[model samples]
Target chain A: MSRVPLTRKGFDAMRVSVIHTADDIVREHIVNKSVVMFDILRASSTISTALANGCQEVIPVVEVDEALAIASRLPEDTCILGGERSAVKLPGFHLGNSPLEYTPEVVAHKTVILTTTNGTKAIRRAAGEDGVVLIGSLLNYSAVAHKLFAAEQDILLACAGTRGKFSLEDTFAAGLVVAELVQLWYSRHNAAPEESCSPQADPVPIYAEEVPVLPENGLLLEDAAVAALRLAEAYRHKPLRALYDALHGQKLAQMGLSIDLNFCAQLNLYDVVPVYREGKITCL
Target chain B: MSRVPLTRKGFDAMRVSVIHTADDIVREHIVNKSVVMFDILRASSTISTALANGCQEVIPVVEVDEALAIASRLPEDTCILGGERSAVKLPGFHLGNSPLEYTPEVVAHKTVILTTTNGTKAIRRAAGEDGVVLIGSLLNYSAVAHKLFAAEQDILLACAGTRGKFSLEDTFAAGLVVAELVQLWYSRHNAAPEESCSPQADPVPIYAEEVPVLPENGLLLEDAAVAALRLAEAYRHKPLRALYDALHGQKLAQMGLSIDLNFCAQLNLYDVVPVYREGKITCL
Candidate 1:
């Protein structure tokens, strides 16, 4: 298991690149041989919830047409077409992109064919990575950290920005992931072990350079970092994770899509991790 | 002056349609429209400092050769050639893009013929606005606010992004300007200022509307108003305005560039506010 420390401030610093499109990410080589999607917004967040609740699989498509095509093969009542366009729910879609939309009653035993303008594109760009492809959001932030801690490669929190741009909410989500990775790395090596078991297993020092964590807190320490941290810390209590709701999320919620905040804000709800593999996103 | 309540978070909500080149800004009818040039790495910050520090005037040219030619026409030892090519100081130029290069000793009473890859192009695009043409940065944040508050028309904060894509630093700077404007609006008019203020009076309120603010803060804020508020609230303390020792300023401090933090931070120092007029920037 390897540990990476990504401070909130550090993450803020590296977020200097506002990735507009998946093409932009690829152009910049943002994948860096490792990639993970950070869509704090409802798409990725909802996918995490759906998978955790009971969905068999998530098919990420770039366009609404593709999502519909995928849905055509599944039983209409057994599968849901979910995603957004211009921040609004697609026409005739069974579900909109909101974590709250994936209630156990709504998503249980279903296959979710999802497509979004940004989230799916980001996932697609990160698909060729040589390492684990875990879904990250505030809901399962810690779970992703545990997975990364146990993995053996570099990490990239590819933010599924709203329409190919940078979203503070997603960056904030990435920062949270970075923070946990750092803490986990430190705990595994630096902190005094409870048992102090074997002499053969030496407690290694947790140097930031070793784990190669993205500095989530980088911007927080900068001129802009202080402000961003204040925003995140201010919402330390609420389902402010709700603040990250995609444009689609709000529209659907207004239409009585889903009322439960628990789905959106539940921390560490699922222990199972979803990994991106061979063009499909699935849980192992 | 009108007090608008702007924050970083609020500014993120609006859609930021970025015009990639100065030509695009012009061809797309964005030139002279409300725009902000976001040069987060250095040039914009440096220029802000240079203007504030009592330099006669900044001749913003695009081509490096043009900048050099303009400098040659100025009085010998009275003009300095400064700018960057690829984030590095141009070969044979007096200075680089680092803020530390511009200083009082170098730039005092001298004109700087400056050209950079992105910032200069952004300036050209913002060549015709009915509102004030003010430079923004961590260096002269308050100065920019004072200028905008006193202006008669709407305000645009353009980010001179790296190349044609979004740069995190520039968008963050735009977030600061938007946040400040929104904050002032909130303080003066309360919640319904949108009902009272003209688009020209406080254009910041209309950030929710699709009207592109020109050089977009696409990556910085998803919701313009909310993102702006969040950014301002994040940096509510620890005045970074005093740290305006910028690229040209640092060089002047040594010999060529002439500027200081006090000058850059001098709120509303330029009684004569510049604005875009007739395809070029001129005094209002």
Candidate 2:
């Protein structure tokens, strides 16, 4: 059941909605929609990282036992266990939920089975029988949007917030995805980006009206999307700085994992757009 | 059922959380917390308007029959049965949910027993076992913030979004409340409004960093609160225009209720802060 039933009935418009946390998944219907899942503080970033580094595939599961079970079925040398509970590596797991741990030297050609406190659960929950689910992060935001641009489907920015509460970094990353999508649309229509629209430009009031849509390509921003986009506009120029300033960023910094923030914050570091379908994530 | 379990353990910190919709209330605990509920498009606005119009207590209920049953027990002349379902005045009810309908001429000296689609459920849900509940709207945002500022409690902005989805106007109004609270904090310490800080000024980046904290007056903004504040900053100068441009605003205009938008969008029109306690709402 769609929370906003009638408004979504007619248009095949790219009506984007941002679900603030994994717990909010129950309030939304994922059927026939395209979901871009973000856990930018790590999970989605890690998937983007691992996939770009030539990991064969990533299997995200909600439970540690499930990840272990999936891994046990694969050849030991061909598969790796990765993820975290309480932001620490699970006992007997091969790696924690950090993008830095998934470098090419480490995960090349290996299937990574992952479980985490929020991200994996978020990815699993955001999936549906008749929808497309793509992993997104600041690292591959434009790539993710490129894959979704021509699809006439509802888009849900599935944010894997920290423990069911809203995560600033995840939503911030989702906003980046939303902005990238809008910028792509503008470019497709032969509209040049305003001087103030550059990611490196100083912050300015980038009005939503800048998104002038053609009738056939109607893109609508739901309330959450509009809010996310505004918040994203504020920190687009200094995304890494913005991410480092998030509460989780501060905590991770304190945890001696400051390396991960720099890893996750690099824009378009990976052009690989990972798609999660049939319980596995793989990318070109 | 606190969504952020461990972090809230030690705070009397006035940590403000913005629940984007009424459905999100389930993930938060209201006990020992003060909630400022906003259904700014009309319900809470109607409450603020009615009370400001010199009405007696406003009784909010979720069901039509309960409103009717309560009104039946009161002196017929002393209670006004007012509410709406699906944005239309309920048959047999004396008034609809529009703030314009609760003029001083109609609601004066009468207890309004209200039953609305989302607003009552939000107000009741935000109330806790041992905390304060206040109805909030753009019409009385500052008054509500003033009441909460010195309370030294965790404050939740319980936004009654449409159905189980997010509402732009409600959160926008909630943002106004958040900004007002911050501005109040600034003013308390004799910090004059920055050149760009006035609500009537052009849109500018009102940095969250502007809110410096003293040891005793520490106010922390949660993720949703931060997002809300950014949204508020974008529209503080033209809130009425912003409200009128919201999806619900256009819907109301289409429904011939455009006049209500002007009424609800008026910031701090009523200095009266209505408190919801023990099943009734009243103000001095």
Candidate 3:
């Protein structure tokens, strides 16, 4: 199959959809688009932070036994086992699913074998697809959006909901990313004429194909995408309050993991974009 | 199993969770709560309006053949077959899944055998649960919330998403319902002081057991619930824009069913609360 690069002319054809849970993902939706997976309460945030802190790579497995089985085969000193079940550290693992735990000293230059209740399952579901799969969260919101805008592919924001149910934090994080992409697309379209093309100066078809294909009226926004952007804007003022009051976050806090809430709430704390391909997540 | 009437004392235990898709519902979540199903784009809205318009009852079947089988057994003059597939009316059916077609003259004193792509399946999923099942939408938002508040039971907003993926309009409608419930709960708590027991009034513990048992901070808002409320508020001002721009709504409009859009976009158009019990939906 031949691939056609998405030019500015295809901007109108560009679309954004949200898969609110792993169970809702359809193979057709991920076939030829860039998929952004968000498990904002911890997993995506942790992986992005680990990559930013110089972790070599993070392997996400769905089960504890699978994580342990893979960890045993790797060099003992090079790989550290990590993950959580029911908001606590799994027995005999080096670390739990906490963003703060994936610090520079602990994960620097090490391969982290990680798994969690929901995030790892969503990652595995998106693996082996024909397109790129990237992990995102509040921690790397802008960086992920920047990458998606540059790629110019139709975007699918896949939220790893809590236990196959719709989760607030993940969906909010997805909305934040969509809002950023919309803003970037609009700014570029507005600046296109001032940069190189003027109606009076340009007689040739210079950058004609580069012009956007938005409708004569304006950009077309999907209702779901618009709702998501509105949701992000509604809760934009208090990032920490939004997380702290989320169902999953409150559950984590009740389990004595309030520190994780503080860490996940930090917006754009990491400059890294974690790209998941071929069963592993690495910094892009 | 014995049932406990949800009193003011049980308010803290009266949790509200949003199941963003039919697939996300677990048997446990519906075991002892009032489940309000929202498929705001069409089905629930249609059914609610039908009941409000004096339709005798609505029988929701998962398959068209089943609908046909049931219609064959009933009086042809009294029962009307209605449904849709892929947003179009099924061939040979008496009516498609459009609210406007269910006007008083056509459907009054008649039983409508109805099925749709997503809404009926969700109704079936919650059919045998031990708790109450009610149909809700923007058309009957206040009525549904009023019933739930009076029941004082735990609430679950079940969104019949588009083919199991989260649908924005449904979630937004769910959020609207949640926001109303929260406001009602708070207002009742504040008004308790002036109702029965006062600072120096008689204290015979008349409403002592009825006092709410909220945590030290008062009401505990789940993150998913809060997100839904915010989403509803975000699109509250532009209800028609919210409906017309929704992904499902756009698809319907593209199919030349813009009439459905205009009908479903009417907020609180009907005062009826459609109750689904024993495999049928009827006005409460």
Candidate 4:
């Protein structure tokens, strides 16, 4: 059975464990087994867009050879090689992992066998965990949270910061997620005195204690929750799910990768929650 | 002779070090022989303020006994004991370390004996070394740079972050010092193009190769410069000079013992450089 319908406030009550390095992700049991990937940089955002545009599947590999080997196995028309070393594009590839490059015209209905410096390394390392594995970015945050709330497992929103170093954009986005999840959990778990002991205590208090609390009813409230909800509803479940739109989403949109962002931001997009199965990511 | 006049561009270039824990700092270089103290929270900021005010002298002690012991040595009407445990002012402390708390009216013309958890410990550790130590913070960044430039000796702007853990604020302040010193060094060194061995042998290229170039003049300009400069400056300085500012100045200011930002900010106001002399801090 599903654990419980975790309200928005319920999520806020929990503290996020900050996974600093690629090694930290491996060492931390909780992170290895239960976290979702959130890379706000051009990589994850672009990958989400590529998937949503009807790509066959995103097979994340670590090394260049690994990506090529996987691509060699797939039908030539069905798969394409892509990624970057630094800010520059790879020497000889069908694409670079820029969301701006993965537009509806370019990547719509193409399978991207990809690897990245950091994000893919994280994905490869977290391949076979026991819990849900979801993609998170600014584009699909609301949809991801709503789905996460419905599932109600302990969540670890892993921010794929640059090369194991802290990046402001990633942390800021994670803070937004923690803030939203708490609010949603609170909405569902806030119980009257009669319902207090019924396994539905308010999650707001828990978040207040563990996480850094922003101003009450402040920008954190509107950005993490309200704006996210609006974006998800507008996409109508097309962006967050499906390999095609997942590769292109809203973060890309504002970054001039709008086509990708539009596709990556879909709400309630996929019924099957992806999980790490047998050293590989698989959907339920 | 003093090294050289510092350029305006010097202080603008900044970098910071993220000392994650007490263990990390200790492991890097912490022994009884090592004269280094820690400043985790607002002690750096407070001390900057105290020196800015008209405080006659500031005394730093490690233990509570040391603080009281030092106070006993001072004239009763001239001295005050101050500091804090957490954010709260200590039981007998005449003041709490907060930038907002220190004002000229209360602190003017007073002598203060101060102690704190992290900053004091770090200061006490670095109490005796060959180098002169001066407090560094946002409040006195320009002044520290000017003093260090004139002294021509190695400058170590140690940050007392929280309980040995890295605090963003302290790290940021450290970066400011690094930026200033590096720029000053660059401007002075770069001005001597006529002294080159050959017309084609510009030393600028060699210098650039030796020192890491900062990021482009963009949004991350401030952050990028701060961390880079801190590391470079620390490495460039002679390693022997050990000095502690905790006994007075910033530490004193934090305890509400006394000083002002203006006083701390005054560049090279003191011709007498305070170096680590004997087992305690003294002006050379």
Best by TM-score: 2
Task: Give one digit per residue, the lDDT tens place, for model 4 in A45-131.
Answer: 666666555554567777898888787887888777889775446776788877657666766667677777777777655433443
Q: Residue A148 error for model 4, in Å?
A: 3.9
Q: Which ten residues in a row have the lowest lDDT in candidate 3 chain B?
A: B196-205
Output DockQ, candidate 3: 0.18
Q: Grade the docking of candidate 3.
A: incorrect
Clashes of 4: 95
Which lDDT value does model 3 have at A16? Answer: 75
Task: Give the B-chain TM-score of model 4.
Answer: 0.58
Candidate 1, position B46, lDDT: 70
Estimated TM-score per prediction? 0.66, 0.84, 0.80, 0.51
- Measured by lDDT, the strongest candidate is 2
| Candidate 1 fraction of reference contacts recovered | 0.05
Q: What Cα-based lDDT does every candidate model obtain?
A: 0.51, 0.75, 0.74, 0.45
Q: Output the better candidate (1/4) by TM-score.
A: 1
Fnat for each predicted structure, in order:
0.05, 0.17, 0.31, 0.00
What is candidate 2's CAPRI-style docking category based on DockQ? incorrect
lDDT tens readout by residue for model 2, A1-284:
33221134444457778888877775355765677789898998999889999999998898888888888888899999998877898899989998888989989999999898888878878875434578888888888877766565678888889877888888888888888877876777687665323211121122222221222455676767766876788667767655644667656765666667767777888899888877889993
lDDT of 1: 0.51
Residues B206-260 of candidate 3: C-alpha lDDT, one tens digit per residue: 1122212224323354556777777777667656556655667656765666666
Query: Global CA lDDT of candidate 3, please?
Result: 0.74
The local lDDT score (0 to 100) that residue B147 gets in candidate 1 is 55
**lDDT for each residue of candidate 3 in A1-284, tens digit (9 for 90 to 100):** 12222232344446777777777787776766778899987899889988999999999999999999999999999998999888789999999988888889999999999999888888877644433579999989999999888777777888888887667788888888877776776677674432211111111122122212223323344545666676688667666556655667656665666667767877888789898877788888
The runs of at least 3 residues in candidate 3 whose Cα sits more than 4 Å from the true structure, single-residue gaps closed, are A1-12, A23-26, A61-81, A90-95, A129-132, A191-224, B1-12, B23-26, B62-81, B89-95, B129-132, B191-223
Better of 2 and 3 by DockQ: 3
TM-scores, chain A, per candidate: 0.68, 0.85, 0.86, 0.63
